[model samples]
Target: MSNTVFCKKFQKDMEALDRAPLPGAKGQEILQTVSKQAWQEWQLLQTMMINEKQLNLMLPESRKYVMEQMEKFLNNEPTDKVTGYVSPDDIVEL
Candidate 1:
């Protein structure tokens, strides 16, 4: 199969899996898949940075920093989601 076709199918499968409310073993599978995709994207970015000489030349340093921060967020480090700017109670015991 062609790389483009394979990637598209994989992406669709991943999106479906991520959206499902799977718990325990099922949830772990989704997390693992997402993490693997994130790692793959990071590797792709490093490749583009090295190969696309003119691409980086067009973007500012601040833009590059923002992209780096975004990559960190995708890798699951602390972000707004975990920082707890606001909390909503989903369940209550009366």
Candidate 2:
């Protein structure tokens, strides 16, 4: 397999993930279309969403919500923003 993929999110070629992040079709789709950088970004956003929304992964609804968000994110659509959160790169060091 090629080490690069045409990332759907960034709309450019980028490094591909070594393996699918999840199981089944969705994971396979992501592995094929989503770049490693985009996936890593999604992971960060997913963590923030889980923490901010107090999502219980044990619940089907929560998982579904996350999945929906993931789709939107990968498609470059608007998603629920994690309030009060800032990226480390956005932080200015003195």
Candidate 3:
């Protein structure tokens, strides 16, 4: 069965994530409050950030930065977009 929650990010009631995405209280909070759609969106943004920043996930700082961004994103705060990235539609598909 699916669970529903008042998703703080989307500002409406929606289906919640099946489980915590991380290992602590914050993760539990997200599982209870964030929707699957919002989490997926964050994942895409996180990927963009990793690429734009050339973050080495093996390093602690990179992981910390990612977690910070995730928190902000889930809280409905604006996140930094990847700078100078051209949208795929702008690229000539040759």
Candidate 4:
């Protein structure tokens, strides 16, 4: 496979991940379609969601919710927003 892939999220050719971020078919699908940049952005969003929502990964519901959110995010569809979270770009330096 080439070092680049047509990223589904970004809708353009971008750098691909060195390997699947996870195991199983989902991981392979992401490896083929999701760009490195998109995956990194997803990770940040996932972390914030977990922290802000206090999602317990041990719970099946929590895991499922995250997976659903991941799919929506990768597809550039609407997903649940993290409340009270601020983007670094939005923060102005005094």
Candidate 5:
């Protein structure tokens, strides 16, 4: 697919997420490999954005919003204690 089509699909996904009115936890699946395999995942993402030239397409506010959400999801501690056949409170939505 074209880059424009891909970006449009991504934008639609973000819009859908924004419309949802629930709190969410970070995506362990997305971060597990990408973050552990590379120490500077965030920095590398920025570098990749620069290389792809998509950074220019993103608004400053949008970039900042992404960073804020990403950091909160990745760095914050989970609040619930789950047992077998049960899930943590923080992961309830998922």
Candidate 6:
């Protein structure tokens, strides 16, 4: 049977991740509270933020910024705004 969690992000029960998504205590906490779906969504957003902002994960400040975003994301708080971005699908076919 698949595991389930009361997702903090969605505020509902959902399928749980098979294991911690990251290391350390924060990862363990996420494993217990975050849903698989929410984690996947965060992964995509994180990638976009890294790419659009040209963040160097090797830098401590960049890593810290991403970590802060992660916490806000999981808590359903307002996250960093993606400036001047429009979804490709949102562009009307010319």
- Which residue segments of model 5 deviate by more than 4 Å? 1-57, 77-94
* Per-residue lDDT of 14 in model 3: 92
Scored against the true structure, residue 59 in model 4 reaches a CA lDDT of: 100
Q: Ten consecutive residues with minimal summed lDDT in candidate 4?
A: 81-90
For model 5 the local lDDT of residue 59 reads 84
Writing each residue's lDDT as its tens digit, candidate 5 over 1-94 gives 2111111212221111112122344343332222332223344444554445434526887567445544543344231221332324546562
Off by over 4 Å in 4: 92-94
Per-residue lDDT of model 6, residues 1-94, tens digit only: 8999999999999999999999999899999999999999999899889998999999999999999999999999999977766888889986
Model 3 C-alpha lDDT versus the unseen true structure: 0.89
Q: Give the candidates in order of TM-score, highest first.
A: 4, 2, 6, 3, 1, 5
Instruction: Name the lDDT of candidate 4.
Output: 0.96
Highest TM-score scorer: 4
As a whole number from 0 to 100, the lDDT of residue 73 in candidate 6 is 97
**Least accurate 10 contiguous residues by lDDT in model 5:** 2-11
Clashes of 5: 0
Task: Please give the distance, in angstroms, between residue 5's alpha carbon in candidate 2 and its true position after superposition.
Answer: 0.4
Among residues 3 or more apart in sequence or in different chains, the pairs in candidate 3 whose N, CA or C atoms overlap within 3 Å are none
Q: List residue ranges in candidate 3 displaced over 4 A.
A: 84-94
What tens digits encode model 1's per-residue C-alpha lDDT throughout 1-94? 2111112214433322233223687445445454445545544554544354334535687457545644454545542232222234654567
Q: What is the overall TM-score of model 3 with all chains considered together? A: 0.83
- What C-alpha lDDT values do all the predictions have? 0.43, 0.96, 0.89, 0.96, 0.35, 0.94
**lDDT, candidate 4, at 73:** 99
Reference-based TM-score of each model: 0.26, 0.90, 0.83, 0.92, 0.24, 0.89
